[model samples]
Target: MIANTVRQFARVQQRRTLSTSVPSGVRYGKSFGATWLGDKGAWPVIGIIGGALVFCGSFISNKIMFHPDVRITPSKRNADIRDWR
Candidate 1:
């Protein structure tokens, strides 16, 4: 009786393993942004906007880091050093 039950259990497990149903026509590769914004004629506009944001960010960061006045005033204790130059 135990052997019959084990055989039935094995049959049920085999059926469960072999009966997996994956839906057809499903896309796994496309991005959510591509789907939302659409796959047609949207890339150039996105590229231009992304490029502008990068350019503006770099320009602002450079302006803050390398401006001449910023280089002259390193700290409060070094204020007198400016007079030597």
Candidate 2:
């Protein structure tokens, strides 16, 4: 009895697989995210994107806070107004 039930479930699963067809571009793409990796199977891609965003945000914040490019001091704008020195 159990064997028959298991076989019937297997047949149903096989039928489902045969009936549904993945899109060509989603199935076959250059990157993992472009393909099924992020198409039907998108959990991994979501995790990757989330982690990358967090890391990138922290990196950018650190750069902005710790390393400032322009140091605005009290320098006169028209101190050296001579033309072609």
Candidate 3:
């Protein structure tokens, strides 16, 4: 009798999966909250990688821009300027 009661309780606790189709990106409230990684998810990783790439690209660009023969100061504004000579 005790085994039968335990089996009944176990059956009550079992979850059923619905056969209905689920729409893409349709996040139920609790499921959405449960899936959250508290801001440590893909966005942060992409931001960090993108930031590093941008910083490195800017550094290389500045180096190329400021090369010795590539003077772009106001003194070299144009060939017709007196100071440019």
Best of the candidates, TM-score? 1
Could you give candidate 3's per-residue lDDT for residues 1-85 as a string of tens digits? Answer: 9999999877766633233457575666656445554445766776888899999999888876865545577666555534422
In candidate 1, what are the lDDT values of residues 1-85, reduced to their tens digit?
Answer: 9999999999999998777756564568888786647756878888899999999999988987766555534464356454333
Across 3-73, the per-residue lDDT of candidate 2 in tens digits comes to: 99999999999999977967555543377545545465687778899999999999988876555452233
Descending-lDDT candidate ranking: 1, 2, 3
Report clash pairs, candidate 2. Answer: none
**Candidate 1 TM-score over all chains jointly:** 0.42
What TM-score number comes out for model 2? 0.35
Compared with the true structure, all predictions reach lDDT values of 0.73, 0.67, 0.66
Which pairs clash (backbone N, Cα, C closer than 3 Å) in model 3?
none
Candidate 3 segments exceeding 4 Å error:
1-40, 69-85
**Which candidate gets the maximum lDDT versus the true structure?**
1
Listed in order, each prediction's TM-score against the native is 0.42, 0.35, 0.33
**Who is ahead in lDDT, 1 or 3?**
1
Q: Which stretches of candidate 1 lie over 4 Å from their true place?
A: 1-32, 71-85
Winner on TM-score (2 vs 3) = 2
